[model samples]
Target chain A: MQQGPDKRFLLLTASLLAALLLGIIVATGMGYMAIGAGDILKIIASRLGGGEALLTDLEPTIPYVVLEVRLPRILTAALVGAGLAMSGVVYQGILLNPLADPYTLGISSGAAFGASLALFANMTLFGHFSTPLFAFVGAILTLLVVMRLSTFNGQISAQTLILSGVIVGAILSAGISFLKYLADEQVAIIIFWLMGSFAASTWQGTGLVAAALLVGLLVSLFFSRDLNIMSLGRRSSDALGVETARVRVLLLLTASLVTAVCVAVTGIIGFIGLIVPHLMRYLVGPDNRRLLPVSTLAGALLLLLADTLTRAVLPVEVPIGVLTALIGGPFFCLIFRQKQKARSYE
Target chain B: MSEQELFAIDQLSFAYGLRPVLDNISLTITPGRFYGIVGPNGCGKTTFLDLLSGGRRPAGGTIRFLGRPLPAYPKRQLARQLALVPQEFDTGFGFTVEEIVLMGRHPHIDRFASPGPEDWRQVDLALERIGIGDLRHRLTGTLSGGQKQRAVVARALAQNTPVLLLDEATASLDIQYTLQIFNLARLLVEDEGRTVVAVVHDLNLAAAYCDQLFFLRDGEIHRSGAVAATMTAETIAEVFGVTCQVGWNDFSQARQLSYRYRSHGGITAAPSPAGLGGSDGA
Candidate 1:
């Protein structure tokens, strides 16, 4: 009898994930004028099955948009979503705070600064490779600074970590604004990049982001038991022979690495990381073994759906980040309300 | 079998930054003995337990277990021999009671290995031993304070370590649960012949259950010996600064220490009513 509900829940989760993926593919395919679901599937099948003539037979413009344009954007959305959610799980686990997200520790601001600097100076290094490399470096440097500042007298309190992150984030934001001031008439490009978009996404960029996110997620899953112990609080975890400080440092570095890669590839896509894990926790419970994987899949689906909406909602393409904020802000308020109700009873 | 010290702390000293929490503390715990540490709050009792458990390194002295330096032992190996039941834990996750208990077997588990049938059996037995078997499937967060303490003890029991260190594991528990945990610790000592060391705040509980007692005051050892010799009213007054009387309880087969009200100006008369079996008026 007990197994019945557990099995049903698992089945429901798997079906929901599959349905979401299919819905994103269909919605993205329907965005263009010439393409339909059937034609999109035929093109995808012909390309995947290595049938060149069958793929070429589809409308020239249709295949180009479906394969080259929409596909890369959808894929990038999925990668960024996964990266953000994985980092969220790691940060929340290590800090033992549910509100911890990748961006909460100033990683996004650091990435913004790096990207803006690249844009303002026309840095050839950031151009040759993806901007993510510079963003990754900037994010890591900021994380190191925040960690050093937070560790006063050889101890890191939760309050100190949060405060340091806020201060450093403000500093980095100011630096980005300075870069914008120095930027020429090309400042519009810098401004749009800061706002975040999927317009510049490519298959190569999507692939790199996906690989980095996959590595991060796999490593986190392997250490799920350690993460579980960490949620018990640091002192008790250390007493249990966990080497708490070492675990926290490793997790923070890994989460930052994932965040830098994602933010560099697709500007700051907000709320998926912050809200997806919170929702998944309420749905499937807070066991990291289940929580991490479920959140990754759910986040990917949410971002893909949101990106599809961005393309379909207006004749002109809306920035994916704007849509996420517009939708996520109200969702965030709902979560706060729920939390308030829960706190009242407690 | 001739001689083996399970734990030996020699001139161990530690401080938080530079505050000097523990100073020149030397003690030895042998196999199959129940040792109790009693001290006033902020007297470095918990810090001493933390040092012995390898959670903190002593600034001055050495700690040896099984004739090897404490730091030399690999973390997993040391965990196999010693298990610590902390004073309080929130356990803020969705782990079941059985799952929490089974974590004690982590040291014995190999990488990527799942718990075996024996591990599950041991966890079941531990829950049963702690008398919380019925709550096995319940989430740890939903349990009451007494139940949570029992679950933690169950986790330590499942560890199956030879030496157990409990740092006020019963502080927040009710009297019944407190006695229950003490009785369980006694059973481990008597039946399994395990060495148990507890940092306890209650003096009576220490006198009743501890085979040996160590009293700490201001980061220094005030007294140490068999319970009958070290738990006298004079020693209690000297260490705790309380006027108390000591007597034997025939029914419980243990010593009992009772404290009297303070006299004027915190001074008491000679042959005061603090003595056991004395009249209301001295």
Candidate 2:
């Protein structure tokens, strides 16, 4: 009898993994100079370990565009999506609020402010890596501040955490706006970064985001059962032996690190983190044990498709961030309405 | 501390900053009996239960469970020995009833291990015992109030602990379901040798179900003993500021108490001969 749901969950996860793989391959094949699916797989295989001899026959520019440009951008987009969505799952579970996401704790605003300052001042202390480093620092500091502000006598209340996030986030947003006003010649650079794009994605950025996603996924899955019990609220989860305070802090720090890495790499790509987990919850239910992995794959697929649409299908390039919100905002509204209707019936 | 005592609370004092909730309260809970903590609205009944479950630390004193200080035991080990059924819960995400019950196995299962066959058997037995086996697949949020409370009780049962603490766990249920929970608590104590402590609002229900009753007034145990001796009309009037008639009920074979508000002073009449007419239906 219990086999029914587990089987369905297994099938869903398998299908999602397949879909993500297909999405990445198909998306890599799309661009101004379109490559065939066969060549795309060959390039991926050859890059993995098949040796340079396999790619020797391909046109130099084809390999260059696919490997040097499109692949890095595509992989970064997918990994950022995965990290955001996974962190979103942890945040929502920890806070016990559906409206929560990776950015609910103001990590995005912190990253944006850091990047904005770097751009405005032309700080090249870290050479090409300066802006992202600043963003990472900013996000970590913001998380620390929020954690400190919310924690009272070693316990972090969910309501206080969110309140602190909003307060800090609002101040940071204002700071970013002030920086934008001060950045006369560099205003375009600041604006573009704030708008968010994957056109500048590189192998190093992809590697960094990938490493973060891997760590985040492992930690989240380890605590998924405890996260489930935590939905019963603090007192009850404590009674159930969850060690709620320790688990809550560890998960919160892990999730914030993942969000910080994603933001530092891809700028603020909202909505994917906020909506992908919710969408997958509707399909898979809210057991984070199943929900986290499935949502990770689905988030990767959704963002890859969105980036492909903006990069290949659209005549003029629109910021991928704008495209996702445009697509996700309405989809979320639909899900919310359906949920309300279902509850009314109950 | 006696070997037979499940909990030996020694001068346990808790406060909310300066305002004391439970002050210098001491009690010993023994195995194989049902204990009820009854009090007025703000009489620290829930706080006392919280202390026993190790949810809160006593400000001034100590609580020893099974001859060891409560804090000395690792959380998971302690959870394996005891379980708490809370009064109100929000299953924030729409987890299924089975999933909720399976959480009872948390302390028993290793951190990395999933629930095995034995865990499933326990969950199934708990669901069956709570009479909600058919509702296992349904989402907890979709269940009615009484059904949700029953699922929570089943979760506690699945924990398979030696001690069960209930903090007004039946306040929302209708009389029928309320009686069902109390009866289940009694069965667990009498047959399984589990120690059960409940914070109940209904005096007659506590009297009917619990082997030992602790009456709390102003954060102190005003009276504590066997139900027949501790549940006098004078105790009820002093603790609750109301007038009650205590009598024997032949139908249920339990001491029953019926109360009327002192504010309604004009309507003085002989105590209703139908003593505890409401609980008789159960």
Candidate 3:
């Protein structure tokens, strides 16, 4: 009897993962350079095996473009998507709210504030990494402050945490606006960065997001069952032996960490975190054990496709954040409408 | 603390900030009996249940379960010993009836492992026991009020604990479902020797099913005894400030009570919980 859901989950996860792998292979070959799929696979195989001799047959520029120029950005986009979606699953589960996402706790705003300050000051402390470093710090600090404000004698109420995030986010947003006003000529750079993109992605950025996503996924899946029981409200979960407070804190912190790392690397990619889990939930049911993994795969594929469209398919490169919202908003509406109609019919 | 006592509450006291809810209450719950906690609104019946279920620590008391301090037991271990069915469940998520019942096996299942065949068997048995077998795959949100309550009770049944605590679980159900729930609890006590502690607002229903009754008033136990011993007109008036006549009902073979308001010439402005029994005030 239980095999029905489990089999469906396994089949869904396998197909999505296969699709993601196929996407990566195809996406790495696309762009103005137009590397062939076979050459792309050879390049990846040689690089992974640490055998440069296998790649000498191709033009030198082709290897450089495939490995140094394109591969990092593609992997980074996928990883960031996966991280954001996984964190979204945790956020929605812990808050027991459909609207919650990775950025719901003001983490994105905090990162934006830090990036704005660095841009406004024309900082070059860490060369190209200066703004991202600052943004990461700002996100972590905001998370700490929100947690502190929400904690009353070591208990964090979901409602209080959200309210605290809104309060802090509003203040930080005002600060960003003031900085933008003062920038004069520099405001365009700030606005573009806030719009979010993966153009500046490097191997190091890819590695960072991948590492965070792996750890976050493991932690999330481990406590996914406990997360399901938490939706029963605090008292029943406590009676069911979920240790609600401890599990909530652990998952919240872990999710925030994953989200901070992703935002630091990608600037401010939106929609994937908020929409992927919801979409997956519709297909997979609300069992977090199934929903979390499937959403991660779907997110990785979705953002990969989006980034590919901007980088190669489109006449001009559009910000990944803007594209996601533009596309995701409508698709989400369609699903919502369809679901509502189905319920009414029932 | 005797080994036979399931819960021994000593000087239990609780307060919602400055305002007291339960004060200096002492009670003991033995195994293999149906206990109905009856009280008017704001009389701390729910709080007493909360204390027993370890949802809240008493402000000034010691609650011992199985001869050990309640807090000393680990959360999962405590769940294996006792289960609680709340008033109602509300969620925006779509969890099937089977999934909800399987959650009762949480304490038994390991964190890294999924529910095994045995756990699924328990879920099936619980569903059958609660007469919800046909609705196993249905989403809980789509269930009727009575069906949802039965599903929740089935969850507790799946927990397979020695004791079950219900906090006004049938308050929203119709009379038929209410009687069905009470009958289920009575079966657990009579056939399985499981302890059932329920917070009930209906006096006659409590009298029919519960072996022992505890009436609470002003955060204290106003009376506690068998229905035949403690149920009377004077006790009802003192605890609830309403007049009632206690009589036996042959159909149910249990003591029944009919409530009436005290004659005050005209309706008073003060709010009362009990409704008018007849057009002519007693």
Ranking by DockQ: 2, 3, 1
lDDT of 2 by residue, B227-275 (tens): 9999898888777766779999998788997766565772244333221
Best of the two (1, 3) by lDDT = 3
Interface CA root-mean-square deviation for model 2? 1.9
CAPRI level of candidate 3:
acceptable
TM-score of 3: 0.94
DockQ of 1: 0.34
Q: Using DockQ, give the best candidate's number.
A: 2
The residue ranges of model 3 lying beyond 4 angstroms of the native Cα positions read A152-154, A344-346, B261-282
Report how far residue A268 has shifted in candidate 2, in Å.
Answer: 0.3
Give candidate 2 regions above 4 Å deviation.
B266-282
- Which one is best on lDDT? 2
Q: Least accurate stretch of 10 residues (summed lDDT) in model 2 chain A?
A: A337-346
The CAPRI class of candidate 2 is: medium
CAPRI grade of model 1: acceptable
Compose the digit string of candidate 1's lDDT tens values, residues A1-346. Answer: 1365366458757976896679766866666564678787877877798587776666677888888888888888877887888788888887777777766789889888888877777777645563666777788889999999999546565667877888999999999888888888758977888778887789988898888887888788877777877776655666555666776777788888888988888888788878888888877777677788878888888887787777766777777878888999899899979866764211
User: How far out, in Å, is residue B102 in model 1?
Assistant: 3.0
lDDT ranking from best candidate downward: 2, 3, 1
True lDDT of residue B272, candidate 1: 30
Tell me the DockQ of each model, to 2 decimals: 0.34, 0.51, 0.47
